[model samples]
Target: MDSDEDTFDNDNVDSGNVSSGDDDFAMEVDISSSRERQTEPEEYHYEVLTTDQIVQDMVDSISDVNGVVNLPRTITRILLNHFKWDKEKLMEKYFDGNEDKFFQDAHVVNPFNKPNTISVPKVTKSTTDEICEICFSRNPSGMMTGLECGHRFCKQCWGEYLTTKIMEEGVGQSISCAAHGCDILVDDVTVTKLVPDAKVRVKYQHLITNSFVECNRLLRWCPSADCTYAIKVSYVDARPVVCKCGHTFCFDCGENWHDPVQCRLLKKWLKKCDDDSETSNWIAANTKECPKCNVTIEKDGGCNHMVCKNQNCKHDFCWVCLGSWEPHGSSWYNCNRYDEDEARAARDAQEKLRSSLSRYLHYYNRYMNHMQSLKFENKLYASVKHKMEEMQQHNMSWIEVQFLKKAVDILCQCRQTLMCTYVFAYYLKKNNQSMIFEDNQKDLETATEKLSEYLERDITSENLADIKQKVQDKYRYCEKRRKVLLDHVHEGYEKDWWDYTE
Candidate 1:
């Protein structure tokens, strides 16, 4: 992945006009412009929506269905929930499927074919013999409520039932009526009327919003901590979605937008790194087994001569060749005889384990180095922002100081790209094309490190111009290298030039 360069452009656009604030509308504008300038349009399109916007979208969807079906809003919402908020599917099924069965399946009463259920009378004193199903008390008509299914309960009982479902159970859109064995869903209006406590009602609303986002295939909550925004995409794919909080994630897997390595491979790499079983593999890689008794041994001393301490089998051997120590005679340090089958077999086995460990560490260390480097990116941003302010004090415009921030952005991009490349390289099987990819990785890594160095170097009045030139030059080169690396990787993906090992 390209580290989502376009997603960060909005933060620096027209530097003079930009200010730190809560609004992200400017970001949406910048994204639109960025997409227009691209030679190849992005595979996915998305919108960052707030809570109110999501609610409005739900209302709009309900209105759209109501325009065609002409059902009550409450019943329409139940039908939509049944279809997972898919209007077209709900419409198709409503028109094509048997009407009575459709309403029954959705746990709703058909508004078109209304059944003669007990009518809820107007608010008044308890004059008629109306017994509440829940409390079994003959309460006033005004003190009782229920869904269209007519399983009425006292107001107190309804409030408790809704509170348990919303606050305790976390059930929102699919909360059914309180009547025993009745699966008919309670609609939002009834919930709002019955649940009088503002806190519980608020929680119920949040739960409904969460359900809408989760159930809809086109929507995803931004994965950043404490961010309340959700992304609505035109379609699902492994493309980046930048939330208003500036967290860019992949729409498909909800991970940080990782290019070069696909989602499945990244998942496998994370699992491998997290697995504790690799500790034993490390021991096998670093230590050797006693040739005679099959006990593990570690060489901590300068001498190569070894002896197994298994009391029953006090076997003596040379650590270098795992052969009988007696054969060395006086040439102890220079034992070159490997004609023994046991020694050759032991040597081969040890080397195989060591080679596997060495290969994994090579890629793992580089991957981790880049990841660790990314941790400093936030501190780097703070440093660059201070530098920008200092440059403005030196008779430079805000526009002139903007390059410092831009450099930091590109540097972060390069670091993220380099981090994901190791995950790509680890599973890659060696071939001519793999060698080319390694070359690209090397070029990007070298440029990224130099860029990082320049950013950290001290800036002063005497070296201001020189520092600006160097920082600009380094970041541009780093950007070019990153693009070239990603382009090659993407091309390889299309051409099937790369192969992976287990």
Candidate 2:
């Protein structure tokens, strides 16, 4: 997962070129950038975060809210939670309205008014000795917590309620008062004072600390299972952002970043791939070997009378009936029609559309197959590491074999991007204008497989230098063709030059 070695803080929006030989589709875009970030062909971006930094961002956001609202930071936090952390909308709607309703609803009744001293609630002596409102047990008024709703409950009852809300569920959960019908949100400070377990309070702190990132639209916690690091991007039409943890993902869809392809089209293609339509296409496009040389021959043009072009073993045969040309008695064309076995599975007009889809699957299946090849190619890193260690035994510095890993990673990324571009091309929607794209795709596929083959072969000390140069050369060639393909597709998408039908 080596991305361009850029820091997360460096989100400078910049422009780049995507040029095909004589064609160009120009558009403006913002991409992640940093100075001298990508040192080699196959690396990406990452940014790690510290707990202190995360907490500071939270504090800063709250402080900003407090400054604008002219309230204490704690009150601002409570108001933020009340509105699900949307400060601007909350202010626009309720800033000058009945402000006390928010404090009362949140149960964050201000102990101080204007400033100066704490305002204490008037405690009645009779109420202290009277029945405890919730548990029906007698308790001193000081031992009971009272919300602004005037509902008094024993500390034990409040503690159990808070535990149930925060511990039985997630710590950030908010619940109402214990008084039968009171819906006022019980404040966290009250929950902390009542709960006996110290660990539960720790969870509350953790929740509040990360709440800023969790609640913001522009920010998201990295999707990595063990990593809680969060990333932030401006809430605009942003491209994918790479995490410090080597997780690259799209800011818009929150899925893996698919550049040079539309998210909508990618979604449709994935769902299409999930169905068996493409799988069936692979079967119908099947090929049979030439009669003499055993070379697999696929029918491309019309007429069943086919001749093998393999110079050493040219053989004439019928494309449909699949036998020697002499078997047709020199004039019979019934072989052009479906034989009994073929007629059983024959579809008439519907088969025409099916054949079109099968044509798409011809490209798509290879795209996906190469994508799988890229994954296995990435695993080759481990194998390359072992080879490097083995080479070190011969007094060759580990640096000598390091080139192998770099070349492989570059090839994998290029091939993957290459594979996804076919999906883009298939859905480009401009059927009449894709001849050049197909040419680029065929060129890329050839160079890509050539590079893959070179890297995938066994590497020993004997052919290390020779194979390294071959991988370098093939990878450069593959990378060039890959870029040409994607550039053509990305330009088509950006400029909307191709009329996307689906």
What clash count goes with each model? 2, 9
**lDDT winner:** 1
Mark the regions of model 2 whose C-alpha exceeds 4 Å error after superposition.
1-48, 82-87, 94-127, 130-134, 171-173, 209-211, 235-237, 267-371, 391-396
What tens digits encode model 1's per-residue C-alpha lDDT throughout 334-373? 4565766767777888899889888888889999988889
TM-scores for all candidates: the values are: 0.76, 0.67
Question: What pairs collide in candidate 2?
Answer: 2-44, 3-43, 3-44, 3-45, 4-43, 4-44, 4-45, 46-244, 47-244
Q: Note the Cα lDDT for every prediction shown.
A: 0.77, 0.61
Q: Which candidate is the best by TM-score?
A: 1
lDDT digits (tens) for residues 421-469 of candidate 2: 7777777665644777778878977887787788668767688778878
Q: What is the C-alpha RMSD, rounded to one decimal, of candidate 2?
A: 14.6
* Residue 182's lDDT in candidate 2: 59
Quote the positional error of residue 296 for candidate 2 in Å.
39
